[model samples]
Target: MIDFFNNITNSLIFNNFFLVLSGLDNTILLLLISLPIGFILALLFALGRVSKIIILSKVIAGYIFIIRGTPLLVQIYLIYFGLGSVKFIRESFLWYALKEPFWCGVIALTINTVAYGAEIFRGGIQSIEKSQVESGLSLGFTKFLLLRKIILPIAIRKVLPSYGNELILMVKATSLVSLTTYMEMTGIARKIMAKTFAPIEAFIAAGILYLFLNFLMVQFVKYLEWKYNPHLRLNN
Candidate 1:
């Protein structure tokens, strides 16, 4: 209706629009900071899972299990309030880092994503043919070299689509940081809605921004997949 359109237009006036955009940038900053760190940790865990050491394997498995089984919001709260509640933590060297809501959210999201990403990567590594490992090992490839030259690259290619989904999930998950009073896109939208008494318009703007971000991310992932899978491109 005309009234709805007018409300949206009015709500998105320059000042309000910029506030919403700032929130989205916060969301993006959270994702950008968390993801690479998470991926590195995940790759290490995945390697541990496939390692021959039973103790190391079990420890990594337990870590993945615990993180994957819990709700992310609960993890966020636990890191933000629960840890911060501890007197010892408050006095520790880590206190400086744990004291901030943004860092707490980053820690939670990174841990959660690492759990999922490790599994995806583990599966991809396992999917590689046994013969390839044999071939690499026979060719004087050290275990480290074999993994770097053979396993990781192939596994990465195999996991790209799944990892892409995980990336998008992390982007959306950043919205939950708002519960900690770290005003990302969703938090800003809520504030605007409260002030203007226009929940629908505020939410719609936030949703569109999220959709746009996810769209660009999805396309980028697809391009990566295509770039890596040359044989598929050749077949096509």
Candidate 2:
């Protein structure tokens, strides 16, 4: 027990604590960039999923299926390595962003999450009581107005817990970008391990950092759940 504590202290304090900490900036940036884009795109996809148009719905379903079925790492590889190899892409304006591991990671993450998020949002939207739609229609609300006024607000609250889980998953998923040499927390931890030959020490610190971040998010989500979900609270 004493040795474990001492080693962790050494790893964090005496080792490359600052360097590992520096990776937090990119980690935060990557999360901030990808999640919002993924979210907006996912909402659009979810709308497609729930659309009355058969072809549009099928196309969205196929996209979500392909993304959810494949590994995110493979998607990352295709974006960074496979797409990067294309002659047209290499010569085009898109290449400027595609060539950078950071942007590649962001694009891959956004694409990957959009599928899952769309499903989550679709579920939430579907969960709204059918009567709720009827109620809006009885009031002569237009489809677009009803959706904006009633559907979106309730669905967002309904999906809070599920979305919180997605948030945690994305936090961990960001670590995969380190493999592309983006030097996020996990990347920096790998470097420390390489230098000190202490995998446990480096990973333990990295794990702790991630754990704390996720923990805080979990608490925040729980608070939101408790706040927005008043009926559940009233039951208590």
Candidate 3:
């Protein structure tokens, strides 16, 4: 049993473990780049969906439906390969960005997340009391001012818990970036296993890293929740 344990450790820590660390860094970078963009786009999409403008709402709904209906892997493949194969895309000014695996992964993740976050935000927005909007208007607030000062804050507070889950899920979803040849944790594990013929150890190490990151994320989210939820804070 001791020998087996030592073998597992050695396999996972082989070659100074720099490769695995690099892979972890890649995953972190992907999340950092994708999350803010996703959040912003989600807000816009959500507002669009709930807008009184019929065309705008329908367009946002269509975007939400298509993204939610398709698998993320397929979306990644389409962005990375399908559009990439086009002569126009390949030769266009945007080719520089499109050619990179990192950018492709970011774009795919951002779009996928925007769809989900939009729905969450929509729910939060809808939950707001109509009286709140009326009160804001009575105070001479414009639509934008009302949203900025009253609606968005309350909606964000309401949506934050679910959004936190979405954030953690985004961290895990970075694993799919491996398909685009990005060297995230899972990608590095795959390479290590192929070279060393030690799948179990390599995968176990990667899994542990993911779990650790996720735990940290959950704790951070909890802190934010505690800080923002006035009722919870006062009770505590």
Candidate 4:
């Protein structure tokens, strides 16, 4: 057992495996960038889902259906390879962006997250009481004002726990980006393991890094829940 600990430490430190794991900026960046962008688009999709416009709602529903039904790995591959394979795409101005693995990963992650996020947000928005809307209007609130103030706040509080889970899933999903040759945490781990022949130590260190990041995210979500649910906090 002591020898195993020594080997793990040696693999991490002397082999520079720890440095590779610690410097996971791209993985963290993918999560940070994709989360906000995906959520913003999801808010629009959610609004469309609940809106009076039949076409808008149906279109958003179809989008969510297609995205949610498909495998994320396939989605990433299609965006990275399938799109990149098109001659028009290669000739078009968009090629510059599409050719890069990082952008492809981001696009895939964003679209995937948006589908799940839209459903989560829609459920939360629909869960809001009609009386709440009536109350907001009675207080002279405009549609935008109602959404910005009462409706959005309450819906966010309702959906936060679910959203937090999505965020964690996204973090794990980033491991797939390694296939595109973007050296995120998992990619770095694979490379280290390949060179050092220490699969257990290398992968375990990588897992620990993910666990640590998710731990921070969980705490942050708990803080958001407590902060947003003031009535609950007050009652407690």
Candidate 5:
């Protein structure tokens, strides 16, 4: 028990908490950069998938299919390693971004996330009752009015829970970038383990940090759910 407690303290306190700080910052950067862009692109793709334009729908569908069908690690490698291999790509200005593992990881994460997010959002859009849509039309609601008032509100509410889960998944998924030599939480943990030769303590510390971050996210989502649903607020 004493040894376990000592190891935990040493892990957190080493070099004035370098491991914790570096890992936390990099992870947050990845989340902030990727999730917002991913959300916007996902929403656009979702809207495209639902729209009547068959060609747009099919193109987005195919892109989503490829992303969803492949593993994220493969996508990361393709971005970081594969892209830089092409002679034209190597000579091009875009190589500046592609050659850096961090940006490559961001690109891969954003692309991978948008696929699942698109599907989640598409489901939300489809969740609106057909009769409600008809009623809106009967009421002479303009297409703009119908979307702004009915579709947008209900669809967003429906999408929140699933979207929150995706956020949590993204947090975990950031660990994969460690393989690209980007020093996020797992990468930091690996470094600590290498130095201390204590894999268990280092990994446990990283896991605990992940749990804490996810807990905050979960609570924030719960708060959003409570705010969105007045009925739940009333029950309290």
Candidate 6:
């Protein structure tokens, strides 16, 4: 048993563990860039879905339906290859942004997260009490002020649990960056496996790293939830 453990620990898979750790920076970068972009886009899409304008709501709903229905891998491939195929896009000023694998993965993940988060946010918004809006108005708040000061805050709190799940999922999803040849955790693991021929060991190490990250994020979200729970007083 000791020999077996040593074999796993002393293998090339073990040495390459640092390489995997390095790739975490890339994974984190992707998450940081994508999360806020997803959040903003989600808010816009949610508002559009709830808009009084029929056409606006329909268009947003269609976007949500199409995006949610499609697989993320397909979406990534479409944006990376399909958009790159366009001569006009290739020649355009924006091509520089699309040229990088990092950006491609970011764009794909951001768009995918936005679609899902928007639906979550929409549900939270719809769940808000009509009395809250009326109360805001009674206090001489304009529509914009009411939404900003009252609706958005309450809706955000309601959506926090789901949004936290989405955030962790996004952290795992960054593994898909390997498909685009970005050297994230999974990408580095693939490289190590190729060199070491120890697929199981390498993958197990990578899985542990991901598990650690997700664990940290989960704890952070729990703390935030506790802090934000209005019914719970800190002094108590």
Model 2 per-residue lDDT tens digits across residues 1-236: 99988987665544666667778889989989999999899989999999999999999999999999999999999999999999999999999999899999999999999999999999999999999999999999998999899998799899988998998999999999988888899999999989888888788778878898899879988998898788878676
Better of 1 and 3 by TM-score: 1
Candidate 1's TM-score reads 0.93
lDDT for 177 in candidate 4 is 86
Tens digit per residue, CA lDDT, model 5, 142-170:
99899889887788788999999999999
- Model 3: colliding residue pairs: none
Off by over 4 Å in 1: 1-16
Against the unseen true structure, what C-alpha lDDT does each candidate score? 0.91, 0.91, 0.90, 0.89, 0.89, 0.89
Cα lDDT over the full model 2:
0.91
Summarize candidate 6's per-residue lDDT along 53-87 as a digit string, tens digits.
99999998898899989988988888888899999
Best by lDDT: 1
Lowest lDDT 10-mer window, candidate 3? 9-18
Candidate 5 pairs with clashing backbones: none
Scored against the true structure, residue 42 in model 1 reaches a CA lDDT of: 92
The positional error of residue 6 in candidate 3, measured at the CA in angstroms, is: 8.7
Q: What's the CA RMSD for each of the models?
A: 2.7, 2.9, 2.6, 2.6, 2.9, 2.3
- Candidate 1 vs candidate 2: the TM-score winner is 1
- Give residue 113's error in model 2 in angstroms: 0.9
Total clashes, candidate 6? 0
Encode model 3's per-residue lDDT on 129-181: one tens digit a residue. Answer: 99999999999999889999999999999989999999998988899989999
Candidate 6 wrongly placed segments (more than 4 Å): 1-13, 233-235
Q: At residue 170, give the lDDT of candidate 1.
A: 94
lDDT of 6 at 159: 85
